[model samples]
Target: MKTLQKITVILTIGLALSILVVFFTTSNAVSSGNETIIRFGHGAAESNERHLAVMKFKELVEEKSEGKMKVQVYPNEQLGSEAEMIESVTFNDLQMVAASAFSQYDQRISVFELPYLFDTYEQAWQVLDGEIGQEVAEPLLEDGLRVVAYFENGFRHVTSNKPIEEPEDLSGLKIRTPEFPLSISTFKAFGSNPTPMAFGELYMALQQGTVDAQENPIANTYASKFNEIQDYLSLTAHQYMPLPVAISEEFWRTLTSEEQEIIKSSASEAAQFHRDILRENEEEMISKLQDAGMTVIEPDRDKFREEADAVYEAYKNRFGEDFVNNILKAVK
Candidate 1:
């Protein structure tokens, strides 16, 4: 009958329209005007290379998307502590964060932070860009973290009120470290009192004598003007911190496939730019630190390396006795 045919056509057309609406809503998570916004947060100073690279990332993302996407970056703990920002990401309150506090999320990540583990940047990159790095970042995926790029923080060094020529020189001195457990254990092995604190509070803490020393990459030392308060800088190269460009998995799922590709490639390119800047300025920054009146000291590394053995003994069994060695072997 003609009436039956009309009903069948109407049902088919309605179902098709419903399917189209569902697909459009799920495929493109945009605002009313088709604009998507990403709120990115970090705890680095404005002058830090990471911040500079993030600016580049913003530029790249906007340019690639032709203004369809926007990135709003908050630096210098403006979004709160690293832990708070990470928590925000999990709940989808924040879209992205440059996560430097890896050890806090997973202890397996801190294995890379062990003393004397990376003798050169090349070795560190080899492992990070390979399977080892993928495996480490994998655990956090379960917690709603998705790593898009690895941003470099460079090798950490010690800065104190007095010269640090050996572990004995550091004896009894309270050294400021991140809440990272490996760093605390490493400093303890070197016979120094490790006082864990946030990076933003470090300068005032040093000025007020709350902590006697701190270790960081040369770039961070210079950016923080550690020379103004700390009188000595030692090239400890204890830990190579490579931060992650982390995005909330929930937020990521909302991005269209094209938008996701733009974000990922932009982050990767920007991070590479940051790594190159640190590498190019490694020597220049040290010279500038010396010029700023901080005495630069290169202590006997063999003695420091020897002391690091204790740190390995402390965490090896916990991280799988062979885990550390396997990473070292890959880089070698």
Candidate 2:
């Protein structure tokens, strides 16, 4: 009886040890094989469509990877302004950023900001999704950033306290613009004094009359409720703002080819979803702005186009006439 009891105790001890070994091994495997976390940052308001698209990207990546890859988004400049965020991504301090191309104007990516460059969104997409887009992406590689996709930033329009029936209406008005030189020049061509300001401070600036007007997409104008302080919505559609979805090249190169492919595919898929949503909701955004008591003005588009020519002439030499001509040819 004594021998049998000893045998039973030994067996029980062995079983407990086996269970602990299995648990430890499984835990180590999970910890080692866990998906990498990518941090994405942007400077748009939480209520903006761009923010919503970021959320969608988060969901899509996680679902496609079965949670093996995760996207964490920082909105409302939680990271910094667009230019700062781009610098962060370039240094690998941040994994990803969705920033307006205008912020990189000094880098020559702002060539896209030339007025009336895109007659239609489709034409813009073809240029962005093709060889020209690849060429533009090449210059950014030196900054340690890789372009994943081009997300729609929609067309830009002017919002001011006074009505803008033509370029004359913008004369002497102080307008707030992004930090891009092209944007400043474009406003200048229209006879307005452009002031560069951060997106966060724009509302207060308008309220305090620090700047009399600003330009942004209908969605942004409505989402920020800029319509409240501003009286007229001039549909300038001067520039097609393309939000470049970029990843740190250092981080991207560290991934296995398979992992890189996964992320690129997921980003492309999410970008299309974003564009579809924007197009569907554009009309609704117009309606909402009208309901919010903002007067929407459809100006003589041709006049606006002609005024934009001055901007092209001024910057073409700097951007390389070949690059400019190629882009224009691609779009045409």
Winning model by lDDT: 1
Candidate 1 per-residue lDDT, tens place, 76-167, comes to: 87988888898878766778889777556677876678888889998887787778988888888888888888889889999998899988
Q: Give residue 70's error in model 1 in angstroms.
A: 1.8
Candidate RMSDs in Å, in order, are 9.0, 9.4
TM-score, candidate number 1: 0.87
Show where candidate 1 strays beyond 4 Å: 1-32
**lDDT by candidate, in order shown:** 0.86, 0.83
- Per-candidate TM equals 0.87, 0.87
What candidate 2 gets wrong by more than 4 Å, as runs, is 1-33, 101-106
Candidate 2 lDDT over 1-332, as tens digits, reads 99999999999999999998866432122223577678888987787778888888888778877888877789988977787888878877788889885345345666677899988888888888888887887878877889988888878989998888888888999999988888889999989899998887899999999999999887788778897898889888988888889998888887778778877887787788878888889889888888889898988889888888888888878888887888888888
Residue 191, candidate 1: how far off, in angstroms? 0.8
